[model samples]
Target: MGLLTNLKDSVSRVTDRLFASEDPKRIGIYGPPNAGKTTLANRIARDWTGDAIGPESHVPHETRRARRKEGVDIERNGQSVTIDIVDTPGVATKVDYKEFLDHDIEKDDAIRRSREATEGVAEAMHWLREDVDGVIYVLDSTTDPFTQVNTMLIGIIESRDLPVLIFANKIDLDQADIDRVADAFPEHETVPLSALEGDNMDEVYDKIAEYFA
Candidate 1:
């Protein structure tokens, strides 16, 4: 079966057998390294909801384990909807752990070890297909959104047939070009916004509500 069909079947089974009124929605934020995945997550967590993304900028792979913040509510069309935003690790092409061999680290350095493994972009794709209810694919508007990494990520999301919202973040930067970024996801939906400055965030929230509605 197709990925979308599989997801629908999974959701259907859950709805049929589990708590009927649960209505728990999972929102996943995905992007390549330094594309502002955590920044956008913090923006949504702070402005829309009281939840916050823990301060982990200097810590490598902080989001690799799927950090979740609960109790997010968005006021759409005069109604309130609860949401849970999951801040995931930055997806990127694979890197060799052999690169770290010369660092003179012991085998017990689990933190450093785990970082080397998650450097692969495929790991994020695996997580998305497994646990995501919807995706906000953050695009670096300052750079080429059609780059190999971004394109591959979008293709995987499409293959899953999941509802994806393209967030053209960093639009406030000098190099940003929202128009070009929007063009990258012509097949999926797109929203241009500056996640850092909180510009156009309401538009993002509205898009999210419509996707699940």
Candidate 2:
């Protein structure tokens, strides 16, 4: 049964990719705040296009708007894939301005950023349903993987039957555990890497070329 199931899945993926349209696949980077979503997206851009998608900061909600780097050309094992990198703002159920103050942001700016972050989350949710062809779900490996947001995100992704790659980011941390992340989302594939150090990025590229291209 397991072998038959695997065979069926393989055939489905091949059929899906063969019928997939257009030149550039839209790959969205999504996860909780400070999960290195933008950093990874920028890393992919830098690898392919000699540029970063957007500036990244330590402050939560720093990326309060969706950013896209279009037409990033990647070639792996003679298989070429053009991708539009969509770096979305963090997904969160609540946005409190006071949290921004911890990052040394002023009250007024924090409040504005908070509002924008709320809107950004909504926009990210919209893109998950409406725009993306595939998703890279980034998770801070040092943190516990079980969370309400993760459940919602995964459920939505699965419902759409979209290709997903769960990224267990920040693996350089002493407490980082890829097993925890894999156990948390056993239904999907997870790649462990340190986006800050550019570790194991080739695996990500290879997965994109193999599964999403």
Off by over 4 Å in 1: 1-21, 56-62, 96-123
Scored by lDDT, the top model is 2
List TM-score per model, in order.
0.75, 0.96
Query: What 10-residue stretch in candidate 1 is worst by lDDT?
Result: 54-63
Query: Tens digit of lDDT per residue, candidate 1, span 22-65?
Result: 56577888887667788888888888776678554533344555
Colliding pairs, model 1? none
lDDT tens digits, residues 1-213, model 2? 277876886798888778878768899999999999989988899989999988888999888889999999889998788889999999999899999998888999999999999999999999999999989999999999899999999999999988899999999999999999999998788999998899998898888887678
**Clash list (residue pairs), candidate 2:** none
- Assess the local accuracy of residue 156 in candidate 1 as a C-alpha lDDT between 0 and 100: 78
What TM-score quantifies how close candidate 1 is to the native fold?
0.75
